[model samples]
Target: MAREECKALLDALNKTTACYHHLVLTVGGSADTQDLREELQKTRQKARELAVATGARLTVALRDRGLATEERAEFERLWVAFSGCLDLLEADMQRSLTLGAAFPLHAPRRPLVRTGVAGGSSAVAARALSARSLRHEAEGDFDVADLPELEREVLQVGKMIDDMEMKVNVPRWTVQARQAAGAELLLSGASAGASSVGGISVQERAGPCDPSKALAATVFSAVLLVAVALALCVAKLS
Candidate 1:
């Protein structure tokens, strides 16, 4: 039963590593996030379940009396690998969501409004319109639709990481080193052999902010100013 649990744990860790790699590749591309998001959810669920099944038994599994020295070492190695893969995956996914949230909720492609002014008036109006659009674009009008889901995902991943850390007193190695050793083991298809585990410092998650009322007021003022300027220009031309 212990051996079966070990194998299943190792397999789950491998799955996590694959998911992390896929996440890195997907995020670096222009592909839609729907698939990536689903995969993340599934992988996280598997990881949480694995932790529940194995965390309570880790102490016995790692004890000198439980298994041979070699077996205990191997178990530690897999734990290290699992920790590193999960750390990298969760950190990267959080970053992607944070950056994604900075984008405008709905960007409508709008052409500049044309006005019949044969003089410097047309130039002035165009400049005003461009400036207004640029300002709003910089304000970062985010979509709250995905914000709640992202926050929930982040919280779940964090809890999973924290739970494991509390359960296992692994070495405080760097994430890069753990990942490197894990990668080497995965590539060589050899027995796991490593001593490493590290936690990343997660940033405080920000809730969604609504700037619609302020944005609407800004837009209204800009439009009114443009209309007034255009009317003045037309009056002067006449």
Candidate 2:
């Protein structure tokens, strides 16, 4: 039973690590030029799925006493790996947004002005101004109008990325805490088991003689024996 539980824990931890690696790769691939928007969406989806799977596996491992110390350490390591992957994802999103915002779209036309005649200069200036105004109006109505909406969408996505990052890290931290608790429980169980084994050895060495003295020794030894057995049982189960 203990061996089986240890195997399950190791398997779960392996899966968690693989999922975290996949997340890191996905986030890193976000920079690929082809179908960037789609890639980003896919990366986010994969990260979310991995985070959920890791949390579920950790919960299952926590419920079993047969989990091994090495398995617990692996689980903690996977949590750290997942947390690091989430940080990379967040950073990647921020970098992509910053790069996208750095380059503004160029204006459709260069500014133009005409001057030659004293009165004609004014007329040409007026005509030039009118042309500029017309160009601005057309571009303004067609393209510039969407800039604010585009910026807002990007900001919204950034916020979502940040929120998801936090969600992923929170579960990893929880798993780490559970791993620590499991370690403590295993150590305490081992200590109790050793103490019980010691008492049993002493009792066996001192052969029965007086009724009252033997009864007291037997009772004391029995308690220690139980403690040792319980500890061994826990260790085996874990």
Q: Give the alpha carbon lDDT tens digit for every residue of 179-219 in model 1.
A: 55568658655432221111111222343555997799999
Off by over 4 Å in 1: 33-40, 43-60, 63-68, 103-144, 172-238
Candidate 1: how large is its RMSD? 28.0
Instruction: Report the lDDT tens digits of candidate 2 across residue range 80-104.
Output: 5545554554554455444433322
Candidate 1 has its poorest 10 consecutive residues by lDDT at 195-204
Best by lDDT: 1
Query: Could you tell me the TM-score of candidate 2?
Result: 0.32
Index of the highest-TM-score prediction: 1
Using all chains and alpha carbons, the TM-scores for the candidates as numbered come to 0.45, 0.32
Q: Scored by CA lDDT, what does every candidate get?
A: 0.59, 0.52
